[model samples]
Target: MEMSSIVLRMSPTLITNVRIFDGLSVVSDCGYILIEFGNIQQISKFPLPTAPGWNIVDGSNSTLIPGLIDAHVHVYQDLKFIETAIQYGVTTVLDMHNESEWFKKMKLVADEKNDVADIQSAGLAATVKNGWPSAILRMTAAADATLETRISGWPDITDNETADQYVATNKAAGASFIKLMQEDGCALSLPFPTRPIPTPPLEVQKAVVDAAHRNNMLAVAHALTNDSVLQMLHAGVDGITHSSVEPINESVISAFKDTNAFIIPTFAVHASSSGEDRHTRQRLAADLADTREKENFLGCLHIMQAGYSIQNSYEQITILKEAGVDILCGTDSSEHLVGTRAGASVLHELWLYVNRCGFTPIEALASATSKIAERFKMKDRGIIEAGRKADLVLVKGNPTESIDSLNDIIGVWRNGERVVWE
Candidate 1:
C-alpha cells in the first residue's frame, strides 16, 4: 500500500502481446511496450527480453492506448474529482474555467500525486458585468453566499485596458490558457435576470483575444448559439469550447474554416442540456453504488429551449468534422453541473462521437487523445512513443473497433505507476 513500493514495482514494467493504438492510429496488432523510470523505454512488434525485478503484465486480447484526456473539465477545488477521473483512464483534464486560487491548490496535488489526473487550467474566464456563468450560476445556486461572493469578484471587463489586465493577471496566476464567455442565454430555457444576458461587446471580445495572444495563451470561447460562435471566430479566438445547439449552417462552417480554429463540441453537456441522452448516461453509470453520484449522472440540465435539441449539436459536430475542422474531445464536466461526472463523462462524450456523430471509433479515440494534446499544445503525453510519459490505458477488447470496449478497463497507468482503482 505504500506509494514508494507501488512506484518501485510498476517501473521497469513490461506489457506484452497487446494491440496498440498509438493515438493517431493502430500501430501494432500484437506488440510489447517497456516502461522504465515513469516513461516508455521501448515499444515494438518483436519480443523484449525480461529483466530482473520487472513487473510483467500479460496484455493478451487487450488494446493499449495512450491515456485519455478530457479536453474540457472544471476541476474547481475537488481533489476527488481528479482522483476519480484517473480511475476511468482519463490521465489528463483540461480545466476550462476555475477560480485561480483553487486551481493552484489542485495543480500542486496533480504535480505531487500520480494517483490523480494531471490538470491544465484556464484560471478565470473573461467576463462582463452580467455575463455567462454568472447568470447560469445565479440560476443554479442563487442561495449560496460563497458563490455570490465569487461572482462579485469577477472582473467586469469593458474595454482593451481591462482585457489586457485580466489576461496578464490570469497568466501570472498560472492559467494555461484564456477562456472567453459569449453566452446570451437565449438558447436556454433558464430564467435569467435579463432575457438576453449581457455579453461582452464584439470589440471587448477582440481585445481579450488580442491580449491572450500577446500573453502567448490560446483563447477558447464558450458559446452555445450560431451568432455567438460566429462572433468568437471573428474575434480570432483559437477554439470554440462548445458547439452551438441551434443546428449547423453553412455560415458556421465557413467561419470555422476562415479562422482555422478547432472545436471541442462538448456533446456530453449538450445531451444533458436537452435531456436527450438519459439512457446513455444511465447505461454508463449502471455500476455506480453511490446513490447521489448515480443520480448526478442520470440528471439532465434540461436547459435547452423547445426548438433547441442535442441532435442539432450532433449535426453541427458532424458538419464541422466533415469540413475538416479539428474536433477535440471535451465534456464540460464539473461537480456543480448536473448530468456530468468528472472522468466518466469523457467516456460518454467519446461514445456520442462514434454513435451520434459520424466519427469512426478510431477517430473518436483520437479526438480524446492525440487531437486534444495537439490542439492544446501538450507535448509530453498524448501519443504512445518512446521517451513519452507512460500514461496509458489497457482495455480488455479492441476499443479501436468498439468505442464501448473502453468501458472495460483492465488497468490504467499514470507516469508508469499503476492506479489503484477504488
Candidate 2:
C-alpha cells in the first residue's frame, strides 16, 4: 500500500481513529489525534472539523492503538532489523540479552541511521560465578596457543561486594537495565546439556539488584526455574524475565503475586532443541548425546503441562491483575528469528495470554504497551495522549475484543512519520 510522502511533511497530521485505547480504557468514536514533530499535540473529540495545513485520514470504522512496544528484541544483531519492526508496528524494543554498549551505539545508529525500531539496551550480561557458558570456550587452539579470551566484564561474583561492582560498572558505563543470568544447566531439554544447573548464589543476586537500585535502574533477572524465581524475588529485583516452567503450581504463582513481581514471559522462543535460548541462563543442553534427552524431554512435557494447566486452572493471569502484579509482553525473538523471531512471534505470545491465560484482548495489549512503559520508567511513548510520544498504529479492527484483529495493520506512525509498510 502506498502512502503520501508529503503527508508527513505537514507540520500537523490528524489520525481520526474509530476506536482508541486511552491507556486504561477504550475511547469509542475517538476523533483525530494531532501529531506534530513526532509527539502527540492533541486528541480532539469526534466530528471535529479538519484543520488547515494538516494531513487528514478517514478511519471512522477502524481501531487506533498506541504503537506496540516489544519489551524484548535484538535489533542490533543485523542492525537493519528495525525496519522489520516498523513494518510490523513495533516502535520500541528492549534489547534484553545483547552486548550492552554495542547495542547502545547501534540504537543511536537506528535513530539517525534509518527510520526504524527504537532500541534500548542492557549492558554486558551479569551471570553467576560459573554462569554463561560461551561457545568461544569450546574452540581449541591449533595445537599451540588456544583461543580462550572470555568477554571482559562478565563479572563472576559470589557475594555482595563483587556484585555491587558488576552492576555499578555497567550502570556507570551506560546500561538501560541490568540483566542477570540467574542459573546454569537448568534447562535440561536443551540439545547439549548433560546434567543439572545451579542458581546464581542468592547473595550475588541480591547484591546485583541492590546495585541496580542504587543506580536508579531496574534489574531484570533471567530466571526459568521456580527456585530461581524465588531467589530473584527475595533479592528484590525489578523484573523477572520469564515465568517458571509450566505446571505453575498455585504456590509458585502466589509467590510471584505476593511480591508484586512482574514476569514478562517471552513465550515465542521457548525451549530450543539446541543451545541456550539466547537471553538469560547458561548453556542449555541442546539435542542429545543419548536417549537421556527423551526422559528429560518427557519430564519437561509433564512440568510444562502442569505449569500451564495450573497457570490457567488457577487463573494466574486474573490473579495477577487482581493483586496488581504488572504483566508485560516480552518476546525473546532474535533479529533474524534464527531459533526464534520472524512473523507473528510477539503476536503469538499475546495470543497465548488471551487464549490460554484468560485475559481480555485489550488487557493483553496493555501488557505489551503501557505496562512496559510504566515498569521500565520510560517517560516517553507507550500511550496515546497529549504530551506523549506520537507512536501510533492504525488498525482495521477493534483488537480490544479480539487481539487477532491486530493483524489488520493499516498504517504505523513513529515520531509522527507514516512508516512505509511494504
Candidate 3:
C-alpha cells in the first residue's frame, strides 16, 4: 500500500464543530467528521465514535466544504501550479489542454501527498492546421527560427482519418477526455488583431466527438460564439468549455435546454481579458503576494485593455443558469496566461457566479464541486460524505452567507492529508 494509505489506515483524523457543506446540500445537523484511509468514514451531529490514536481537529466557527475543483485549466509540466492550487483550497484541477509528452511525468506526482492538487489533463487538444491556438502560439512562442517549427508541431486534424489518429494518440498518452478547439479568436462581432484563424470543420469535429464516445471518453469543445456553440452542439459534444458572448436569445437558450451538454463558462477569463469586473481584479490584486503573480495580473490587465470586449457575458451566463443548463466553474488559469492566477482565480470564478450571474452561494459552490464531478464523470471526490475521498477545505465564516468568506481559507485537505500551506 502507499505510505499515505498506510498512515490513514493507522490514524483517523476527526474534525469537530464545523458547518458542513457536503457538495449536494448543507448539513445543518453535522459538526463532526471522521476521515481515514483517504476517505470520509463518518459525519455526525456530535463527536463520532472513534478508536484510540485518532487525530482530532477543532473547527470552531468554521465551514467545511469539498475542496474546490477548477473544471477548466491549462496545466504546465511544472508542479508549482499544483502546489499553489493546494494552498488556496483547490484540490483538483481538470486541465483542458496540455502537451502529451508531459503526461507521464505529470501523472507520476498527480496523487502524491506532497501538497499538490491532483490533475486530470486532456493531453494536447485537437486543433486544425494553422488554427485558433496557432496565433496564440505565435505570439507566445520564442521569436527564434524554431517558432514556426513549434507552431507546426500542433496536431492538424483535417478529416476523420486524422481525427481518429489524434484521438488514438491522446488516448495512448492517457488523456482523460478529448478537447476540441472551436475558437475562431474573435469575440462574436469583434475582430482579432491578426487575421482570424479557423476551427476544425463541423465534420471533423463531429468525427472526433464520435470517436471519443466510441472509446468511452467525453468530447469537450472550446467555443466562444453562438455559431461555434451551435456547431459543436450539433456535432454532439458533451460539454462547451467557454460561454459564448454572442447574444443569448430564446432560441439559443432553448437549444441549450434541449441538450444535456454542460458549460464551464470560464466567465472570470472573459472578465479578466476584457478588464471588466474591477471588484474581482482589485480583490485578486489585494490577495497576491508573489511578485510574479502581481506582474502576471498586471500583464493580463494590459492585454484586456487592448483586447476586444465580450458584451453581456454576465447576462448570457445568467440566461443559461435560469434556463436550467448546467454551469460549471473554471478559471482558464495558467502561468503564461495573463489576468488569472493559478489557485486564486477559481475563487474569482465562484465570486462571479454569485455576484454577476445571480447564483446563490450554494448553487455557485455546487458548480465547482458536485456538478463538475458529475458532468466530468469523476467518481466520488466532489462531495463530503461517507465513502467519498477526503478532499476538503475549511474556511472561517459561512460562505453561504457571504461568498467572500471563501478567501479566509484556514485549512485544506486532499485525500485526508492536511496541506501544509504555511
Candidate 4:
C-alpha cells in the first residue's frame, strides 16, 4: 500500500474494535475511539456511528494504548532521534539536559511535524565547574571540540545567586523543568582527573529546587548512589532521573517517602554501564540492518564500578514500587549513549520492569504512560479520555498481557495524524 493511503489526515478517524489500555489499566476489552482535529473527540465501549469522510481502521485483534513516554532522554540537536522515536510508539520524551539553542530547533521540529515525538527539555542542567557529565564527557567524547565548547558554556552554578540565575535562564529558554546534576563520578569506573567529581553543595541544590518551584517548574535530579539520592531528596526536588546504582536501603526509602518524589529509573543506561543486559540488547537489535545503528545498540559502556550491577537497580525499583513511590519509565537513550537507541530502548526498559523487577505487564505499561504524565504534570496526552491529545499506538497483540508485544507496532498517531513511516 502507498504510504499516503494509510495516512490519516486532519479529518475525523475512527479506530474500532480494539482493546483499550487507557494508560492506567485495561479500560475496555473492545472499544472504539474517535479522533478529530488533533484530539480524542470521544471513546466508547460500544460502536460509534461513522460518516462517509471519516477514516476507519478496523482494529480487530489489536490493542490501542496511550503513546509511550520516555521520561529521561538527552535529545541534543538530533532530529532523527525524535523522528525514529515516534515510529516505535514513543510519542513524547523528557530531555534531561540539552543546549538551549539546539533544544529550540528541536522543539520547532516537533511543533511542525506530526512524524516526530514531542519533547519537553530541561535546556541546561544545574552544573558546577568540572562536574558530572562534563567529567564523563571529557573521558568519552574529549575529541569533539564542538561538544567541549558547548560544555564550557554550561552554567557554573556556585551559590544561591547562581542557582537562581540558572533556573531562570533555563525557564526563559523554554525549559519545562529543572535538571540538577548530583553526580560525583564515584560510581563510574572511568579514570577521571579527580577521583570524586566536583558536585554542587546541598544548599545550592536546594536553591535550584526552590527556584524551579517558584517558577512553577519541577526539579528533577541525577544521582547514582544512595547518599546522592538522599541528598537530592533532602534538597526537595520532585524526582530522581536515574536509580541509585548502589543497593536499596532504608534511608533511601524513607527519604523518598518524606519528599514524596518519583523515580524515572533509566534502567536501559544502567544495563549499558554495568555491561549487563547485552543479550537483551542483542535481541532488541536483531532486526536492524544498518551497521552503525546495530553497533550503537550492541555497544556497552562498562563504566560502572565493580560492585555496581543492574540487578541492584532492579531491586531498587522493586522496593520503591512496594513503598508506594512512583516509577516512571525512561531509558537515558541518546545519540551517543551506548547500548540504547531512542524509542527502541523504551521497549527494553519496560520489558525489564516486567520480566526482571517482578512488575506485571500492565504496571510496566503504566510506568511509560500515565505515571509519567502524572509525575511530569503533562495533562493532555497520557490517557484515552475525551478531549485528550490523540497520541495513540496500535499494536498487533495486547501489551497489557505481554510486554514484548509492544514491538509489534501496527500504527502510531501523534496529534490525531497518522505517522507516515518511510
CA lDDT of each prediction against the hidden true structure: 0.91, 0.65, 0.81, 0.91
lDDT of 2 at 380: 87
* Residue 159 C-alpha lDDT in model 1: 90
Q: Report clash pairs, candidate 4.
A: none
* Deviation of model 4 at 373, angstroms: 0.6
Candidate 1, residue 219: lDDT: 98
| TM-scores, each model vs. reference | 0.97, 0.81, 0.93, 0.97
Sliding window of 10 residues with minimal summed lDDT for model 2: 297-306
Model 3: how far is 165 from its true place, Å?
1.7
Model 3: per-residue Cα lDDT over 246-293, one tens digit each: 667666687787877899888667766676665676676785777777
Candidate 4 residue runs with Cα over 4 Å from true position? 1-9
lDDT of 4 at 304: 93
Model 1 spans with C-alpha error above 4 angstroms: 1-10
Can you write out model 1's per-residue Cα lDDT over 1-422, one digit (the tens) per residue?
25456556554989999999999999999999999878899999999999887889999999999999998899999998999899899999999889999999999888778989999999999988878888988888638779978988887899999999999999999999999999889999998989899988899999999999988899999998899999999999999999888877889999999899999988878888898788988888999999999998899888899998889889999988999999999999987588999889999999999998889999999999999888888889999999899999999999999999988999999999888865
Q: Write the per-residue lDDT of candidate 4 for residues 1-422, one digit (tens) a residue.
A: 22233234456999999999999989898899999878899989999999997889989999999999999999999998999899889999999998999999999888877899999999999999899889988899738768778988999998999988898889999999999999988889899999789988889889999999999999999999999999999999999999998889899999998889999889999998998888887888888999999998899999999898889999999999989999999999997688999999999999999988889999999999999988888899898889899999999988999988998999999888988886
For model 3, the superposed segments whose C-alpha errors exceed 4 Å read 1-10, 141-150, 188-194, 301-311
Q: Candidate 2's residue-wise lDDT over 339-411, tens digit each?
A: 4443245665677678767788988989878889888988788888888878888888778888877777888
Residue 410, candidate 2: Cα error in Å is 0.6
lDDT at position 132, candidate 3: 68
